[model samples]
Target chain A: MKNLWFHLMPYKDLPDDFREEHPSVWVDIDSGLLDAERVHQHYHEYLDELEFAGEVGFDGVCCNEHHQNGYGLMPSPNLIAATLTRRTSAPAICVMGNSLALYNPPTRVAEEFAMLDCMSGGRLIAGFPVGTPMDTIFAYGQNPSKLRDRYYEAHDIVMRAWQEPETFAFNGRYNQLRYVNVWPRPVQKPHPPVWIPGGGSVETWRWCAEMDYVYSYLSYFGYKAGAATMQGFWDEMDRLGKDRNPYRAGFLQFVAVGETEKEALELYREPAEYFYGRCLHVNPKWASPAGYQSEATIRAKVQSQVALAAAQSRAGNGQNGGGRPGPMGAARDWEQILDLGYVIAGDPDQVAERIRQVCIDLNVGHLMLLCQFGNMSTELAKYNTRLYAERVLPQIQDLFDDRWEDSWWPQPLEQPATARALA
Target chain B: MRETTISVGGHPVRVLTGGDNPSAPPAVFFAGIGGVPTWVPFLDRLAESRRVIVPSLPGFPGAADFRHLDTLLDWVVHCVETVEALDEAPVDLIGSSAGGALAAEVAAIAGSLVNRLVLIAPFGSHDTEDPGADIWAQVPGPDSIPNLVCERPEAWKHAWQVPEGAEAIDYQVMHTRAMEAAARYLFPFGDTGVVSRLHRVDHPTLLLRGSEDRVLPTSSNERFCAALAGPVRTGELEGAGHLPELDTPDDLAREINAFLADQELG
Candidate 1:
């Protein structure tokens, strides 16, 4: 299994009544509640934890872009990935990734991603995401109706800019550029490995399957809530007659680890409550901006609804138990979070056992672990990262070793002539 | 009244036509985001003197679902093609709310097609500062409590035919379709740069408003009156709201006749 560490970088301190007072943590969030010094501290701690993940031998370190959001501080995840290029020799410097629709020229993505590739010695996994409505349509004022169309065009432009040697004119309906040329083409020949992070959108699953890119179910909701979404993706792969290679998918989940379940609960309660209560307290109004979701996606939500209904039924039964209050939709106590599987918090052995079962059941190979979440201290995050790497990672590291080949992983790096000669 | 589908650029656009006499100039009615059905009564009243044509702009229910009309330009082109189909030399154009903005732009784009223009709380222009009360925010969603489209809820309750007790998918689909149509012309607040080219409008225009309407503020409607190039007339219905034609058809008909009669120099 490919273990990756993910970071959300939420502001450490939010008010007790943040849920009641602030209808949303995105779009039109009150700036009065934010302290510059606190965010400055958050950045330092988040970077430290990511670097520690690399040091502790995670297969990849991931970051993603979010705009006008208090929950996620990294609007330019590429900037963070660039910083990680120097800090660690990790296998993949995953900038999971740039919101292509938001960029004006889009060739800018090609240029920066290529730069990161060269700097990391060919260790770059490019993530293409159709941003959330709050980030794309509301905050940026992108015409919701035309956002996906623009996204596809931008993706085409960026890909061509990276691989195509000759300059060409891009006459997209939204973007019209006279000439497109990008310096420092990526080191991975054609381009870096592409991973598409989806949020239960049918179009995304189909697009990912057709493109042969990895479909990542990156929901704040725990694996238990997201199993249906993952199953739908696997089902699509089956319908398309594609191989059910476990590497074809990735899943992100919140997790905490300690010597025992009691200690884990004590360590993670505040952060878990903060995340459920504050980070996910987005206003429903900002969530859907007219045409932000395609008509087909809106219709396909019925299928998701069925899947969700099944999950809820399972939750009601003792079969799929986790947080009592659920991971997403509202704030919950640590016990509720634990009951709902929003976080696999326990001793190293317990975490490994739960994580192993989650992986086997969902048929996922790339496990993106959220070790640093909602106000987790840098020191505690480092400790958890180390524990997961040393104890939990060994228990199930060999489960998918012989199952399927990961076409999505970044290719191994080439050593310099001097280093080879010395060896 | 006869409802039929007309072919424009190989796409079938549904239109409702009533009281036709080829010799007399037709009154082309541009229906709002709700489509052309509710305007049946108002169109019947307008049809008393002369012919009337009401075409559903693409993307709304009862109209072509395909996204052939991709941009606002495509919509203007469709309206132009629609006018050409009528072969009417000088037709009076009347638009309501979202449709009002469409009619105003149609007149601006194809000036010769329109002889005189009347707008009922049209959505195209806005003041950057206050930017009128947001209509999208006010529109009822699948989960939201049904809000009145006009000031007097009972007067036009039937006019805003909001879906009820639909399955999750159907509810979402209905809400999404309406929101999508609104986003096409009025996404960031109905301003489509009509303010800059209002001088291009060769026809006299009437900017009508409902005084008590909160959606499109009266202050912003005043800007619309000032932006026009030709002789402009303005009026407000005291008790009515945004959907004035639906709420007070008699008063709206009186205002329409008086304006058209004066413009005809009769």
Candidate 2:
């Protein structure tokens, strides 16, 4: 129903042999590979593309946090979100959010999010993510065992800091604050609608359901691979006797549209290959650190499709022959990528049909479309965004809106003539 | 071998006790990163002369949770309390790898409870120049066992192998939990700032390391030797890895026993 534009802002110029030459795309990725001039140019171009998404017609624009990662350039997505707030008017600035555990005194996040909300005139969708093992545990050096504990405590502190009018003393296992009073309160009463971007953690689903927050599954693998995780989330909601309002869930998908299916596929092939092959060239060792995943989630993962594929790969090789390359590791041609539904590439009608089917199948209400991905030039990104905005978005925008109210969406105040004049 | 539970800090810790001589002061053995889930042969050899008490540090096999211990200081206090709760004051203390660092801390803080201290490849002091291999960075399961816990990973498979009747995934979870517990204290940099406090320990101490330890550098042993205020002796075992207890248990046990007896180690 709500088509939001998402950007990974990946470094587009990684050499063709990056996968072979580089140990990983994150954490310890060699600093020599990055070009300062190119990165500066890329940042300006990416920001322009995000603003263009707003001007052309996206309901929201999204950015997320990742540290020491080549694929995700934004270590501090708040800075990007802050810029977007001043530049874009109509679109919600969705910062799919800060890794809570990394902040020393997490009230820093509380203060920054409040500032963004005020800057955006209340058009802010606050995202709280229990960041990736690469970001939180490896890059930030958070104790994996205590990461979740620290995140939960930080969440409580941030929420209390935002909602509590009076100054308070907070004591937690991970953090102890003497006087907790956040300045410059957010324009949204009680706080902006909270969205939790998670990577198939079972505890995250249960927590989202219990807290009545939107569970946004930000999967790089497309909807076909993401269906199970989304389904798992809905099932948990069902078990908890919560309504399947659909607005409670969000799904991210890589989409590129053109005049014809063949045209779209040909247009996106280079970027798709670059994104999947090089951007996702993470070392298997860094994939899952100890205690980064909960035991229950690990159990679920063992029975998942990815695990089955790994088992088959191991069987094909000798018993002691090293681990199976992850889902993103194997070399995939364009057809395999399309067949596996890693990206939805087609004409407007075809793209709309596939997206609608995916939303209905997964019961997803917020469709976070990653129109700009790895190595896509500014011209190509705008072309993809404009084409989708002109044709595909209209067909899918009203699918769930009439049936359900999106409580998770931000309710921004109507802009005054004076504010527009100042801009 | 006898199995019992001792309540330390109100949490029941699983302890393994064995040896021929009960009249002598008990020898408390704190396990390394590869926790003692079952009876290890190295403990058996050490138990031959004196009573050996091996407590499954929290989040390891018998002790199932380390969440209650908030900080490294809390872990140290818990270790000291476990040692004190044994009703054997001034006992000979031996720790291996991660446990070695912990044992050194206990000896530094509670000198009265530890008569003699033995640290096998201890991890309390860190030298930035010779910072060892990143153990936490290694992939979990069979692939990393050689780099982390043992020299002969094939032979020491039992250290992390899935038990009969237990699901493979559960074994993975257990192994990960143990590693997580270890990471809680020694993450990022394996230093706990114990090097500065080592001057407090006045007891006779012995430091041992495996010649082939890939997880810790030889500089760590030197760091401990330089910082320790007590009478210190250092030895290295040939053909042993980070966890010499599982690599060359006979040689490791002989070294520990000799150290506790105040005799020259062969």
Candidate 3:
């Protein structure tokens, strides 16, 4: 099992009545609410927590791209990943990653990712996300109809830029590059391992399986809410006649570990509420742009749990009348958040047990554990990371390693000269 | 009304033709975002005198995928080809909302194919100070119907009603497809550089706006008028919204006919 530490690096100081006052946490988020000095402090604090997770024992540290939003502050996640390469040694620098469609000439992503890979001595997981509708279609002004087309074209360009030994002229519908060649080729032969972080788009599952890439479902809602999506992925794999090599999939879960279940709840309740309440207060308007979802996805979603919950809400029965809370809807209380599996908080043993069950149930080998969430202080983040590293990780890390080889993981130089010189 | 499938730029386009007089130059009607699934009462009124031909712009309901017309240039070329395929050179072109923008573009680039142009609540020019409501931002459903597209939501609801025996989900998908196609040109803001190209449009033009239009700003009317290098006539329809044809179809049809016949405004 591969346990990676992920950080959303959310703006920790949103007002108490942020959800009430603000219409959305993204796209048109009130610029006045953001404090530059605090954001500066947050960068250092969040970077420290990520590095601490690496120092403790996480196999990788992950970050991702979001734009014009308060939810995830890193618009340029590669910049964050670049810093991680210099500061952290043991962990894989996972830029869970650049939104390929947003780059004018997507070769820029290939160039920067290559730089990060070389800097980290090939410890880089190249994440190619189609990006959120809010990020891609709304914030960046990408045409929803053309976003996926541009993304696929960008992906091809990036891959060819890295692997095609000779400089080539590329002509695609969205992009036309006269000369396609990345200056600093990644240290990893044939490029670094590709992981696609998706929001359970049915097409993504088929694409991931066909490409032999890791399909990482980065759900804000934990394993319980994520079960259906992961199951759909494995089912897709089965349909494609591919083997269920657990390493082929990844799942992200928010975990808060402590000495006891009571202590854990007490320690995490505030941050958990903050994350679920304020951070996820996205306006329903910006949630799903037209053309963002393919016809297949839209058809599939008509019967999806979230859509069913939405229908119930529209029928005036209320969303939380029964069953789990919908992923997009706010879960304000700690009890509802826990009940919905938005966050998994308990004693180390209990947390590990739940994680083990999750892995076995979902068949996920790469576990991206979000130890630090909304408004979690740096000290608390470190404590949670260290506690999980000390107890929970040990019990859960060996679950799938014995049976499956993680082909999707990065292959860094065994003993780097830089490391030897530092030692 | 007679319906026929015509190949325009190698894409099958569903065209609706109707009128009493076929000898008069055809008044080619281009529809707004919510396409002409069937002939609305407004088109019926326009067909009373001269021939009316309405072709579903690609990616809208009754049309092929919008992907075929990727850029604004592609759309303009497709429109030109569509007009040419009708075998009516120098036709009277009438467009509503999004289609209005397309009509203006078509008239600008291919003036020889257009005798006169009518743009009703067009979306080509954008005013920063009074930029129209962001149509793409509105959530697709009943709640957003009024704010984004119409003044009278209840009346306009029938415009997008799910056809008899059609599944509601399928209707929703169709609606999404149409909106996606419109957003290709109008996303973020509705400005598509047609304002600059309006200079090439030397044909007689008529611009109409809904007095209560919530989508296109009032300032946009002036922008469209100022940029057109032609004799321009402008009118406002009361008790109407962005889609005047749906709001006050009779009034809209009268205005269109008067402008097309070169009658003085009352």
Indicate which candidate wins on DockQ. 3
lDDT by residue (tens digit), candidate 3, A5-48: 99999999889999889888888899999999999999999999
Candidate 3: regions farther than 4 A off: A305-327, A419-422, B263-266
Error of 1 at A43 (Å): 1.1
Task: Give the range where candidate 3 chain B is weakest over 10 consecutive residues by summed lDDT.
Answer: B139-148
> If scored against the real structure, what TM-score would every candidate get?
0.91, 0.95, 0.96
- Candidate 3, B-chain TM: 0.95
Ranking by lDDT: 3, 2, 1
Candidate 1 local lDDT, A1-423, one digit each (tens): 899999988887878899888867887888898999988888888998898898788999999998878889998999899888877775488888888999988889988999999888888999998888778887888878788888999999999998788989999877898899898888887789999888877778888988889989887778887787788788888889988888989999888999888898899888888888888877776766677778787677656556656887867763433322222354377776777678889999999999999999999999999998887788889988999999999998887888677888887467612223223
Model 3 lDDT tens row, B121-175: 8988887789878777776455585556777776567767777998878777777
Clashes of each: 8, 0, 0
Q: What lDDT tens digits, residue by residue, belong to model 1 across residues B171-255? A: 4465567657768767777887777777787677877887767677776677777778888889998777777777677778778
The per-residue C-alpha lDDT of model 1 at residue A42 equals 85
- In candidate 1, stretches whose alpha carbon ends up further than 4 angstroms from where it belongs are A303-328, A416-423, B20-25, B37-40, B136-140, B143-148, B152-175, B246-250, B262-266
Candidate that beats the other on DockQ, 1 or 3, i.e. the better one = 3
True contacts kept of each: 0.42, 0.73, 0.75
